[model samples]
Target: MSGSDTVFNVKPGGALHGAVRVAGDKSISHRSIMLGSLAEGVTEVNGFLEGDDCLATMNAFRAMGVSIDHHGEGWVRIEGAGLKGLQKPAGPLDLGNSGTSMRLLAGICAGQDFDVTLTGDASLSKRPMRRVTEPLEAMGARIETAAGGTPPLKIAGGHLLKGMDYVLPMASAQVKSCVLLAGMYAEGETCTTEPAPTRDHTERMLNGFGYSVQRQGARACLQGGGKLTAARIDVPADISSAAFFMVGASIAPNSDITLENVGINPTRDGVITILREMGANIEVLNPREVCGEPVADIRVRAARLQGIAIPEAQVPLAIDEFPAIFVAAACAEGTTVLTGAEELRVKESDRIQVMADGLQALGISAEPTPDGIRIQGGQPGAGTVQSHGDHRISMSFAMAALRARGEIIIEDCANVNTSFPGFVELAASCGLNISQN
Candidate 1:
């Protein structure tokens, strides 16, 4: 299986059971690489996600003179390049399918003394970059994107950025982090006010590295002159990755599963909140703090779900997990209405439209709204759905087979390695009758 040539064949009917730990947090993993590479000393990271996306981040830093040693099984050591130490790559830094790498690296590269270009695979090339570039531009960083603000970002270095108060046009952590990361090299204090709270991993991790990021209400501010000292990071299991199993165990009959060491970061736990609001049987166990982020064991069991309008406030919190959330809606007892999520339109795929089309193909009534979607709970029938090279969409539809009336075959599933690398094997271990070819 390679590229978009992979397909997933899932049989109807199964119950997910047992305790499993998913991959390390993708956002945290990405930030660890970025911050570690920029810090003053060797940063030892435990529980690093070895997914293609995060690895792409690692490779990008390595191309800039940072030395990173992979010690296998979720452990890595990074030799810092300091705030102004990244060298110009011989060519464009290929980030593969990682938007995080392209966006965040654009910020980091903006203050360097050498020019660099950031490129990606076909799918990532089509994703927008202006959200970060426009703001970085406002801060005096020179960046150029292709038409429609897409990827292949060429960021001109040696620009002296000056800190300014930035108001985010949307609730995007990547954009906020972009501005904040670029702020590190700016002339004064940099602050960003978001319309809604996003994952604060970058802010938290920055502070962990001896840099101070202040948060008051919806605003986060930091001074540009501070230097980052290296720190150890133990990434909790990604709640987004745990979400598939959570929804799987919630919807399937007699299914009960416990996910260990999952990060329940307040800003990123909307999926759990939404599912619970829809009558999911979920329990938060052994809640504690891990390196300034909250961690917990989540237990989810089968329940009869009744859908309601998803809270608009939680949209930013669970933005990435909506693909799986939509699957839960299809199996619920009523209609699930989602709005205030126009962000879905610009993800790896137009999630709202893609999920709606796939659900409709599977005999469910899913209407794609401009900002969100309307899903009518009903039984899913047999279908061949297209993932469109989107990993989350492929995995979401695979879980749909649990309540499907017949077998479900998902196309273009090879991108699952971008996030959850061993998805098929891990899914099978928990009783998901899935195979890939």
Candidate 2:
């Protein structure tokens, strides 16, 4: 978890079995710390993601004088700092590889009384911050990004922000959440109209904290100067993390596995929908709600998948799960065509290109387009692939080894801890012949 030189060696031929629970939802874990620190009372969180990214969020709040106690194993207590209570940090906030932390915090810092600078590691530094910064600037916050609209985002504080009705240039929950977070300190109502529906965790969590976010069709609107009241949050297992094994069980022979307590928030369930459309045998068992998010146990069995044209509408819904979905496409019986996912080009890596490159290295026919990719179903042949330090890419290829004809070695997998910690150990326990070095 501490080095960027980690490698994963996965041997071919294994069937995933038994029940497994992934780490808490990364997106929700992030928002919990952000909103909790801004609330008026103490907040207790269960199933919090202890990944490096969420820890970065916690450390950021702590640097601003918030007290967060980690009870270990997915439990956290946040002593709220209240609105207008956050202090100026002693130095720049280093977010490591967490774009979520950097982007969302940019909006929060924009409305602060003290100047704040948000920074990140190399990968995150290259990601586009203008998507959030431009919108926040429109709301009357002074934000300066690096050349070409990247990070270390310098937000000049003490500006009285005035909210505006904004239209998102793209479908992004982070951008939407950023503007909305900044709106809390604005002088008027802030509204975001998305071209397509993205995750609504921010809206849902705001309601949980006794803040009102109005939803009408594709638009979410909230007035400024609202108070956030502390509440208990139970973060569900991240479906994105569960996706690797879900694809593994679907592709590997005699594999049957149940993923427990996973978040099935409708906005984020496109991965399941896409997989099911590809002929995956997945069942939603014990569907329920937890902490304003849908939760369920997912049981997936080995099935002969036949790839189809991925529905464009589901693109924004499962944006982060496409890496694993690509692996499923490789093992399926026909070609998988994905489009309306240009967002993939700007993630931890150019996921569209990275996944295509990895799949091709393993002897799969993959062609990357500007927005998406077309993958031909086939058995993967062994080869070393580069993960570009992308956690999802690393895990996706590891699962690909299940159907590989030879050993698969993945390079630069140290970033796996950014999202899914203990992934190798958990995958190994579930019968994936994977080892970390």
Candidate 3:
């Protein structure tokens, strides 16, 4: 994970069977410590993501004078500094490659009195912050940015942010969470509406912390100035993380595997829906509530998958999984066309072009559209694939490479550490012959 490139060697496999638990829900893990550090008392979080990105967020908050302690294992105790208590850190908060941290922190900073400036790693710095900053300004916060509306945001001393019923041009969890966090300190009812739904981890976590947040239609209404209370949360397994397994089982012939503790939040279940629509045998087993979010064990069995047109409505739900979805598309019975998903261009990579390019290199006919991709499905061809320095793209092709008619090699695999840190291990455990070469 510390070099110029990492490589993945994926071997074909037989049916896969086992129960594996992934890292904690990354979205909820970020919000827990954040909301906890600002609540009235200490919040206990179990199953927190130990990933680099969430750790960056934790470190940034600690620099602001909040108290957070790691317990035995997979547990964290965050002491609330209370609302309006985050002192300015001595330096620019370095959010290394985490757009989640950069965007969510932008909103949190909007209501603070301290003079704070938010910065990020090379990749994070390149992501557009204007989406979050634009809304913050309408709330009466002063924010300055660089050209292209990217990061290294200069946030002046906070102001009395007024709550507004802002409408989002795009459906993004980061943007929605940013506005909701800012609403915590606003003076009135703060609300946000999106053209389409995104992840609602913040709203669920806030309710778990005893804050009353109501959702109306596409909008979430938050009563400003309501203090968050101490609570215990067991972060569910990340659905995004589980997506790798779903695609792995769905494509590997005769495979059946179960991923435990997966978060089944309605907004994040797009991957499951799309795969089931393609005729994969996946079952949601022992579904229950942990804290306030839904959790389940998902069992996936490999089958002959048939392609179907992916609706634009489902785009917002499965936005992050298209790289892997494209893998499913490659093996589906017919042409799979995806539309109304232009956001894929701005992720860790231009997923549309990167996937289409990589698939083409493997002899699959894939074309990147302005909004999405169209693919001709069949047996995967043989060739080397590039990850484009994007974690999901790297892993998606690694899985796609498994079904290749020839040995598959993936370049630039170190990016997998950003989200799913031990991704190669997870793949190997699932019976794929994967190695770091």
Candidate 4:
């Protein structure tokens, strides 16, 4: 399967059973490459995600004079160039379908001493980049963007930047991390106040690299000119990747599955919280810490779910897992209302609209609002759902097939490789009758 030609034929009538470990955390995989490239020594990373998005991040760093050795099977060694060591790339850095690479690299590139243009594939090219560029420019880094602040970002480097206090209008980890990465080269202390809590991977990883990132209330601050020493990172299984199976086991009858070594950082565990509140049976076992993030074994069993009003406080925490959570909502007994998630509109696709459309296509009632969605749970019928080049949307609809009355075909599923590579095989190992064609 290649590109848009890829499609998934998923049939109903299987209950997900047996244990499975999903791919390593995509967020952490990206950050490891970024931070490791800037550290002072060799940074060894185990369990790195071999997905296209993370590979794009690695390639971007390689373009900037960083040496990364991939030893097959998720182990990687990156020779750091230290701060102020990345060389000018010979051409525009192509980040493929990764918005994380483009956005975060924008911050890192702003602090460099040479000009670089960051470009991406069709889907990523359409995503707005001004969220990071605006703040980078505010800190005195020169940046030019496409019309309407889209990609093909042109950044003129070698500018001396001065850090300033900035309050985020929206809670975005990418935007926050972008400014923080640029802040490392700025002149003073850089602080970011969030309207709501976003993922703190950057802060956690910064601390692991021997830099100090202070957190007080909703604000996180770091000083510039701090050197990052190399460190070892064991990337835990992604909770977002674990979410599909969590919902699968939760909604399908006679299903029970355990996901091992899943990262359950308090900031990123909203999916578990929301599902448990909806009356799903989920247990966190063997809770421990791995590489500065919380890890746990999650056991989920099928339950009769009853939808409740999802708390607004959890919106930022579970933003990425909503598509799969929406599938769980469709299988629940009542209505699930979600709000304060307008950020979904700016994702790889407009997630709120795209998921709503896919759910409606599958005979579920989902109404899209400007900032949220209202879903009425019922049986899902046979239908073809478009992924809209969004990986989560494709996998979410596949999970929908578990409870569906008939077969469901998911289109444009090739993008699944961007995050969860080998998804079809893993889903099948867990009892899903899904295959790519």
Model 4, 2-121: lDDT tens per residue?
568899999997999887899999999999999999999999999999999999999999999999999768899999999988999999999999999999999999998899999998
Q: How many pairs collide in each candidate, listed in order?
A: 0, 0, 0, 0
Models, CA RMSD each? 0.9, 0.9, 1.4, 0.9
Q: What is the C-alpha lDDT profile of model 3 across 246-278, one tens digit per residue?
A: 998888887889999899999989998999989
What lDDT score belongs to each candidate, Candidate 1 first?
A: 0.93, 0.94, 0.86, 0.94
Q: Candidate 1 overall Cα lDDT vs. reference?
A: 0.93
The CA root-mean-square deviation of candidate 3, after full C-alpha superposition on the true structure, stands at 1.4
Task: Give lDDT tens digits, candidate 2, residues 293-330.
Answer: 99999999999999899999999999999999999999
Which residues of candidate 3, in runs, are more than 4 Å off? 1-3
Candidate 1 deviant stretches above 4 angstroms: none
Q: For candidate 2, give the lDDT.
A: 0.94
Per-candidate TM-score against the hidden true structure:
0.99, 0.99, 0.97, 0.99
**What is the descending lDDT order?**
2, 4, 1, 3
For 190-266, candidate 1 gives per-residue lDDT tens digits of 99999999999999999999999999999999999789999999999999999999998988999999999999999
Query: Comparing candidate 2 with candidate 3, which one achieves the higher lDDT?
Result: 2
lDDT of 4: 0.94
Clashing pairs in 4: none
Q: Which run of 10 residues does model 2 get worst, by summed lDDT? A: 1-10
State the lDDT at 18 in candidate 3.
Answer: 87
